[model samples]
Target: MSATPSRYCHLIDEGEVFLERCRRILGEIQAAEDDLSAMTTSPRGRLRVGLAFAAGLPLPVISAFMERYPEIQLDLDFTDRMVDVIDEGFDVVIRGSELKDSRLMSRPLGPYRSCLVASPVYLQNRGIPAKPADLLTHSCLHYRWQNSGKLYQWPFKKQQAIQAGESLPVTMVCSNVEALIYLAQAGRGIACVPDFAVKDSLADGRLDKVLTNSLIGGSTFHVVWPSSRQMAPKVRAFVDFAVENFSKGLVS
Candidate 1:
């Protein structure tokens, strides 16, 4: 005899629940397999990392990491844009901004300070900025934010009050920090940049610090990854390596 209509509906509901249970069981089994594999084998897989543009820490860290783990291959993406860790399939992302996503985990690498820098020629020709207000008259190389398309603010300590529509004189604008550094080194204009990126230049006298006592923009770099029940071996290794290397005050 044929089942009643309500009985058919009940069967469909039961089947749906059964499929869901099966899917969940399969997921658990896969997770267990992954954990077992990770435990048994060394970190030897492709690791995708997202890095901020022109952050000085990547070169040394990447070189050291590859030397230490020769089996693991690295895929690096460098950009100033904010990346989605999980959705973008990045195993790790290093950024100078604070973490906002609750689904991700972060480890602080170190702090970096920003300062206004210019070539000696530029300073001599344009005159050194005695204070933050003097920047209004000097040619400024500005950094345009990749995500917001707005100019990066020159965070100066004890900033003076400005008139209704006063702003720094912008001679050029670019999104890449390295480009700004290059231009500043070429005697183009004064550019605000992370101090670590110009350490050698400052030491060799290729660039001179401007408004040294007034600029106060700095932030800590963080290595971020997706939150998981068991962190992958490759991700764990890199995180530990980064923390150890950066703890030595290498990045300034």
Candidate 2:
């Protein structure tokens, strides 16, 4: 082959880059076509999902989803810490906190409220807390936030005197809401938790509400996914299913 002049050497490098870019574009087009075909045929793919630790308590939703979509494989990650939907490659994430990321598209699952609860035995032994101030004297089962490493503040609507920095009489601290519920049921201490989590215990006479008039905390859950021009079929199916089921008083 004839030796290329120095002036034309840069063109060779640019040509190589142009060819690489063309290959990349073709690969992307093929992937997009595959996605479209899958959508039109059936929602079948590996779906990576992240759920808040407490959100996993609704086993029926998970069970029903799996039963309905046997072709789709589910990869679930349960954690209390915030997960990045894009960076972590999660197709969907269900969380009890407010949606702050503008890059995510979200659908409201439902609202859930936190309340003070203790075992019937515990209430008998320590006496029912008639007011929010009474918690200072009672053994409190505290939930420490996984992300911030701080205790969850029990929101008492009537007790403005209870400052944020004020310490409660903490007996046991856990990051998992289910553990705290179990501890409360075992008559360890009074716990503040979401109402949906302790529904069975309350129905079975294992736990009872405390300070119902004063203590109040609630938040809506959201199903979030990365924003895109078009959502994958599997992701869309899960999001719609969650919204439909959860809206029927599942979380509330």
Candidate 3:
């Protein structure tokens, strides 16, 4: 045993040296792997979305998206004016009506119907319009967009007889939908508002619909984004989530 001590000591020293080399190589490999992963990972980005007041009815869907993607920042601007998403740097726009712009990519989410409504007090005070022609004799609430420089016309399904020749008459004009509804609630005039806005009022006997036969056809709400590759991942993810959730009847 005493004669073998030198050989045993030499072998122990070599084994320790080999382990030290193995550890150094593994450390270098790990560091290299971490650097590679850092290069491949995508950076977080901000997404801004615009919505019309009518589109706010689906806030729950938007909120769910927020919960799912906490890393992405969301900015929402609510207005009726059609915003230029590219010029203004918005990533997405949720519009209340069918989109017609050729510069953007749009997907229809769902449709919503409109009803002509007046407060019962107004109906009692000024009588209901029997037909579209009868609206000429009543006070009307008009929404004139401030920026668009266009009047939001009251829409109705016209009979084949009058579709070719006549247009509905307007008596008074306002600039905002909420104000128009307020004026109608105050018994000032009649308003053509979306059913979502007035459903509770209608159910609670605060508002009554008029000209049911001439109800306005539904408007299709859409999700729009610039048709460009520059769109970030967050924007695309949010848009996909919205379309899915809205289609599931989770948001209306």
Candidate 4:
């Protein structure tokens, strides 16, 4: 049968369109397979993590992870500085990130409760603070943020709004929370550090919690990673493990 010239051209155009669609579908299929493999397959690579100095709480669990994946190596950076995860080449950062960037992915660990604590000796010598307002007369160990150049104030319960009338000044200050805890333990002053940081001391009577009614609202920790079309297997593995175990009770 002799086909009209227009009909023949239309048939050829349709065939071309169908072939292009097939190519696109195949490409999508391949991408899906790659993503599946990335998640299901055993990952072997180095993971660089930036964290707060209080990594000890969650880090203990990482020892088990290492035993499971002997091929994966870890590089840790324990500093309070707000790390540039993407520019600094950190595979992941576990910190109290604000999570404002749209170009990043995050998983919340959990909220931390700030505690007003002092060594037993400090309390014995200085006398325990009867109320949040009493902190004005007592010495305070301050936390100075390196990135912001701001001293953290002791956050008290909103119910005691009168007690938290203003941010009190500190006599002693440092950038390290651990240092502040150590100084507090040495009876230098009462330190307002993350509850996670002082759990052991509080349990063993090294540190005593004062002003129990006026607890500070601490920030939530998150596992943040750079957003990409193809997430690395190593990054996924660590993020999942952290969210499952380190997200809660590491401090509680």
For this target, which candidate reaches the highest lDDT against the unseen true structure? 1
What is the Cα-based TM-score of model 3?
A: 0.70
lDDT of 1 by residue, 1-252 (tens): 376988989999999999999999999999999888766678879999998756455787788899999988999999888888999999999888767899999999888889889999999998998877777888899999998899998887745533447888889999988899999999999999988888888999999997777866588889999998778889988888988885453454
For candidate 2, lDDT tens digit of each residue in 42-132? 7788999998757346467878899999989999988888888899999999988766888999988888889889999989988987767
Worst 10 residues of 4 by lDDT: 160-169
Winner on lDDT (2 vs 4): 2
lDDT of 3 at 125: 82
TM-score of 2: 0.80
Model 2 superposed RMSD (Cα) = 6.5
Measured with C-alpha atoms, the lDDT of residue 9 in candidate 4 is 96
Candidate achieving higher TM-score, 2 or 4? 4
TM-score of each: 0.81, 0.80, 0.70, 0.85
lDDT of 4 by residue, 121-230 (tens): 98999898888778778898899888899988567777664443465657798888778888889999888888888888999999999987787567888989999878
Provide the global lDDT of candidate 4 against the true structure.
Answer: 0.82
Deviation of model 1 at 231, angstroms? 0.5
Segments in model 4 whose C-alpha atoms lie over 4 Å from true places: 1-20, 158-167, 247-249
Error of 4 at 55 (Å): 6.0
lDDT of 3 by residue, 78-163 (tens): 87887887799888898876567778898888777777889999899888878787776788787787678677766777561135
Clashes in model 4: which pairs?
Answer: none
